[model samples]
Target chain A: MGKYLSFSIIAIKHGYKNKGETIARFAFYGIILLVFSSLWNAVGSEKIGLKPRDMIWYLAMTEWIVLSYPLIHTAIQEDIRTGNVAYLLTRPIPYIWVKFFEGMGTLLLRMLILAFAGFGFAYFITGGLPTNPLGLLLYFPVGIFASMVVTLYQSIIGLFSFWLQDATPIYWIFSKCNFILGGMMLPLDIYPEWLQKIAMLTPFSSFLYLPVKACLELDASLLLEALIKLTVWAVIGLIAMQLIYLRGVKKLNVNGG
Target chain B: MNLKNNYEFFTHLLKINLKSLTSLRGAFLLQATFMIINNLVFFTMWWVFFKKFKSIKGWEITDLCALYGVVAFVFGVSVIFFGGVRSLAKMIDGGDLDVYLTQPKNTLFYASSSQSHASGWGDVVSGIILLWFSGYLTFGSLPLMLTVLFCSFVVFVCIGILFNSLAFWMGPMDSLARQFYDFVVTFSIYPQVIFSQFLKMILFTVIPGGFIGHLPVSLLREFSWSNLGFLVVGSAGFFILSVVVFNRGLKKYESGNRFIGVGTN
Candidate 1:
């Protein structure tokens, strides 16, 4: 635990040395959320009659998906390109656990920082704040579970680099596919009935929407459904990741150090 | 007599570069993947935007797709053909110019061409798909569509050179170029209508983002002489400026500088 924690923290510290680019990325995302939040707030009031409190709920709930989602791309790309996977393999800790936890650690810090920034930006723009204390209570666990779903999905794709030489193109395909299914771009609830049915079969929605729904509506029946869905997807993700890891390691004679 | 030799030298240089990348499969494949990913991301961004607004500033899915398609196709071609532009600073800094300069070729031509980005090649495919989709929706004549695509090709070269010449003055340019690419890409995903007057001017004259997709796209939407004029002039000006800047930077290069090497600089 100590070793993996230190590894994850040190990676962040090393990465922070070149803080300008990352700061810009965080700011870029912040700008997108701000622009959309302001637009949606006005549109919601004018068109859909959603209240300010509901706006805040949307903002807070989507935070995990927006911030941590990019990390899914970055973590996978970096680990493969830098050959850091080999370093993790050298560690005494089980490679999968180390990767899983280290990813959690890095993403946790990124999500917290970006979420706070997104919240501040959303608040100033919309003058909206979460209405319910229970939404606040459920937010943390939902965030953790959502992030886990993202990390696992991303790492599985990243590890494919061992076989394919470069995984970004494929990752792009899957990640965009995730945007539709995961409800990262738009809520599954809003999708057409057919699309919604298809979306449910995929685990992407479990990554972003389930958490957001839990936080925003405080919909108890929906929460129960989300929990079940999350558990099932998490298990499937674990199985898939295991198969990917085994295949990737066997094919790991890639030329670059 | 020397001029004749210089022409021969450039031909030989092109032949060599063509040979080099032909054998480098891994890098090419990786580059192709990166380009495809970029295309997918924009597809998502636009899909969601179109979903939310029903329309953004009088634009539809077809319009956005056209803009994205042109940008993607143009940018992909630029990257594939001018890949070395992204590496200009590092190549200059690391004294790698020794390799290019010693060959009896125009250093600029040799440097710019045969820098194929594999990922961009993949993007080219997706770009074609989007372009075809948009054209099928809006364009009535196939020949006219082909003519505009050719203009878009010119925009590709012009904007690429304009952006690449920045490696002359910028530091650690890989990231700078990346930021530039990101900025161009993000804004390009939307209709140009929402841009303020000042920004619209910047896009038209300075950055030539207008020509990159907007002008030709407008033509596709509604044939207009003014839009074509904007496209032609903007592309010509930026293309000229970038070449001049690159030549100016080339003169300042100290080909064998050791300080810019790993240990010293």
Candidate 2:
């Protein structure tokens, strides 16, 4: 636990050191927010019961969730490709734990930076934050759990690199699934009934939609349901990651990587 | 180079790129397949949106489909023909300009066309399907549609080169360059009516997302000679600007002491 905490602290320092890249990324996020705010303002005016400010706030939260997660798959894939995974295995701590802690550290810092920037953008555009401040505060833990679930899923995709020469296409497909089914651009409530039903059944919604919805609306029942679903999904993701990791390591040992 | 020589060089580069891409047929097919699915899923979001709201500011499901088709087709054509535009920042930052400098050919043209992406075929297929399904594929509109597509392709490639050329001055700015490219592409897929006047102005001039994505679709939907002329002139201007920028940036490029053997792959 202490080792993992230390890893997280080191990763946070690394993120702080890379302030230039973070600032550039934050600027890009601001542009994206500006575009989306304009889009929602225009579209919401046409649609019934759609408030542009609320939708923009929802988008701010969802985009923060999307951008907060580090691209752990890319690092893992590179390690496997370049035979660095063998060196990683020799470390005192388990490779997966190291990755998880480092990823968490980076993700926490990035989330704060992006969330602050995103909220500031939203406030500047919409002139206020969401009305449900308590809900927003409560959403931090749920968001963290959701990020872990996504990380585990990405780790599974990365583990596939042990077998496939290039797992980029597979990762692309997974990301598209998250973008569409997860409702990154728009809330799932706005989707058709059938599409909403399908999306709700998938774990993708738990990643962005559920968290954003909780932040904006603060529905106790909905939050409870989302928490339960997210917990289940996180467990499933962890099991999948562990299974894949074991098989990948076995293959690597046999192949002398 | 002369026009004829340039045409011949482009064709030769296209052939090499295509051959290299097809060298691994299975991987190519997988990539193309996944890209098609990815695009279809993206379209589904709009499909769902239109199903609920019917239309936003006179832009219907079919219009959105056409918008997607045009943007996807333009993007596909650019990546397929001049895929290296996608990696221009990385190349510039890695000092990969050494080989291009040694050659007598135009550096920007050669660098931009040096690679081809197989997934572009998926986009082309999905885009044509969307255009046809949206009833944009009429005999009367075919010429106009093709013209819009060609102009959009020019604008797309120009935007890519313009952004990626920043690496020559900013060092290895892979993420920043990519985000700008992605921003342009994302803004292009939406209806032009969604933007306010200020946003619309930015789209046309600063980012030129409007010229590449919005204006082309709008021109195709309603054939206005004036708008078409604007698009033509805008695309030409952007293309010339990109070339000028690339030339200026080339003077600042310092080799990173990396040996890149030609034809090694």
Candidate 3:
């Protein structure tokens, strides 16, 4: 656990050093919020049961989770592809936990930046803060847990590199699921009842929509539900990662062996 | 190289890329399939949006479909043929341009087309499907659709090169280039009516999202010589600007510093 904490600290330092990527991410985040704000503004807040400002803020929070998600899968893919996993396995700590903590560290830093920037920009665009300040406060922990679950899923995707030539396509599908089904751009209540039901059944909404919805509605019960679902998903993701890693390492036929 | 030679070389490069991708049939299929699903998933958002609101500022679901069809197809064309555009930043930053500088062929053309994206095949298929079902595409309008698609493709490629060339001036601009490129993509899918005049100007000029996203859709809806001219001129202007920017950047490019290769496998 201490080693994991150290990995997290190292990642934060590394992220600080590589501020260029953060700026780029900020620019993209700003652009997405700006564009979507315009869309919602044009759509107007009628019959949707949420104000345009709320929708924009919702998007900002969701995008924060997505934008802050560290691409640990890419690193894992590279390690497996180049057979560097062989060297890493000999380390005292497990690779999956190391990656999780590192991703959490990176996400922590990125989430903070994107949170301040996103909220400020969304405020500027929508001309007001979220109606519920307490929900905004609750966003901190919920957002972090959401991102942690995302990191575990990314680790599972990365572990697949042992068998697959390229795991990016799988990552792409997962990402789109988070975007569309997870309600990144809009609220799930706006979706068809059937679609909303399906999205709720999956863990996608737990990471994106439900948490933001909880923030928008200022409901602690909703927040609790979001956290509970996120924990369930994270546990499932961890188990999958462990099983996949063990099986994949068995197939690890590095060169010169 | 001459025009004919450049055309022949590009075709040959494309063929080699296709053959290489098909050689790994499983990976290629998986990638293409995933990309198709990705597009559908994104489109579902709009589908759900329109289902609730009916339309946005007079733009119906079909109009959105038409807009997305062109955007997706053009994006697919750019990545499929000019896959180098995606990695131009890394190549410039890493000085991987050394290999291309020694070649007898046109550096930009060869570098851009040397690789291909198998996932773009999915986009191509989905674009056709969307356009076919949009109720706007007909035999009579097919010629115009093709023209719009070509112009949109040019805009996509030009935007890619224009952003990528920044790496030559500001070292290692992969993220910046990608984000800037996303600016165009993110703006292009929405209704043109959503933006104000000032934002529209930025989309038309700075980001050039209008050339691919707005102008083409409007022209398809109501044919106007001025709008069509704008699309053509915008594409041509960007092409010229991209070539000039890339050439200027090439002059500043330092060689052989890149430790690793930067393009597709």
Candidate 2 scores an fnat of: 0.59
Docking class of 3: medium
Writing each residue's lDDT as its tens digit, candidate 1 over A139-242 gives 77777777777777777777777766566666766766676777774566666677788778888777777767766778888778888888888888899999
Superposing every Cα of model 2 onto the true structure, what RMSD results? 2.3
Give the TM-score between model 3's chain B and the true chain B: 0.95
Best by TM-score: 3
Please identify which of the two predictions, 1 or 2, would achieve the higher lDDT against the true structure.
2
Q: Candidate 1's residue-wise lDDT over B207-253, tens digit each?
A: 55676777777888888777777666766666677678778877777
Error of 3 at A168 (Å): 1.1
Listed in order, the DockQ scores are 0.25, 0.58, 0.78
Interface RMSD, all models, one decimal each?
4.2, 2.1, 1.1
Error of 2 at A20 (Å): 4.3
**Candidate 2: residue pairs that collide:** none
Off by over 4 Å in 2: A45-50, A253-257, B258-265
DockQ of 2: 0.58
The fraction of correct interface contacts reproduced by each prediction comes to: 0.17, 0.59, 0.80
